[model samples]
Target: MFSDRFDQLVQALRILPSVGPKSAQRMALHMIMKNREGAIGLAQALTEATDHIHECTICHSLTEDDVCHICSSHERDDELLCVVESPADVMAIEQSGSFRGKYHVLGGHLSPLDGIGPEEIGIPYLIQRLSQGKVKEVILATNATVEGQATAHYLVEASKHLPLHITRIAQGVPQGGELEYVDSHTLSQAVHNRMRMK
Candidate 1:
């Protein structure tokens, strides 16, 4: 219920996840009235980030370079690879300071209803990477949701013949919990106490 420009701004704001129409409208108004400078800065940052950030060629994580920092780091353990649903999960695990290994982001979990299967989430690519023989262990760090569990199990089955040790992050994270919302301590514990999935 506003001018075309205002409505357009609200709609743009609504593109953010979980932002409803009303919340978007409120945000638009707040930015226009109370924080125009911040809004401009945010706009510039968003444009720059969107223009420059691309997926890391190796791990599929958001990065401005061909390889992400974690993937290029020499100090990190190359033999240990952590599989996660998204780059956000990688950030969560990094913040925990419990894992010093490389990562493979699946982008999403398998959801048959959504028609997202192994091929859609790059499972074959992961298997190809595993086949290189540099990695010795893989940690399944997907969320605790049913879809996450199913995806992890599928990965286990898909890589059964590979000469690699597969493990799932242990309990501590509540059922249905996503890594992004979990505390550092809990995530650290989960990483430290992971269980074999074989």
Candidate 2:
């Protein structure tokens, strides 16, 4: 068994997603014994990031600024809006460099049992934005999961009268797959081959 501080470090490391107790302990040991400087840098970066990072006002994506670059950019297509479940999905799509449109991050998908509903994930705000009529196309880029599909369908129904073209990314993303884990080429192709849902 290690000291209290070491145990605390391991516990803290375990706070990261998918990090188990053994992995946390190993990471703690590596940070303390082999990469103390690197660990310190990582700690500072995390602290600074947490201190500054906040959601973009327009798209609900993580950004240090009030508005994300994509939302504010003039070169990006203002008529095309890609709706994603999380900021990670936004990052994945951006990394793919396929879609030249703006984005609307839903924050999360619909989960009735979990009590996550339309208002809970900023769907009303999305409808408001769409109602403004700046965006002509709405790409339902939510993950391929059941909840994601439900959310997309709900959005389609919710904004049926908005007079905007609603489309869904191609099925190349695989069934029940999250966007963040999908490969760039696959994401690109999916965006390219998107089908109209409305």
Clash count list over all predictions: 0, 0
Candidate 1 residue-wise lDDT, 1-198, digit = tens: 669999999999988999999899899999999999999999999999999999999999999999999999999999999999999999999999999999999999999999998999999999999999999999999998889999999999999999999999876787899999999888997898777899
Best by lDDT: 1
Model 2 C-alpha lDDT per residue in residues 71-109, reported as the tens digit of each score: 899999999999999999999999989899999999999
- Which runs in model 2 stand beyond 4 Å of their true positions? 172-198
Question: Model 1 reaches what TM-score against the true structure?
Answer: 0.83
How does candidate 2 score on lDDT? 0.93
TM-score of every candidate relative to the true structure: 0.83, 0.85
Predicted structure 1: lDDT:
0.95
Give me the displacement of residue 192 in model 1, in angstroms: 18
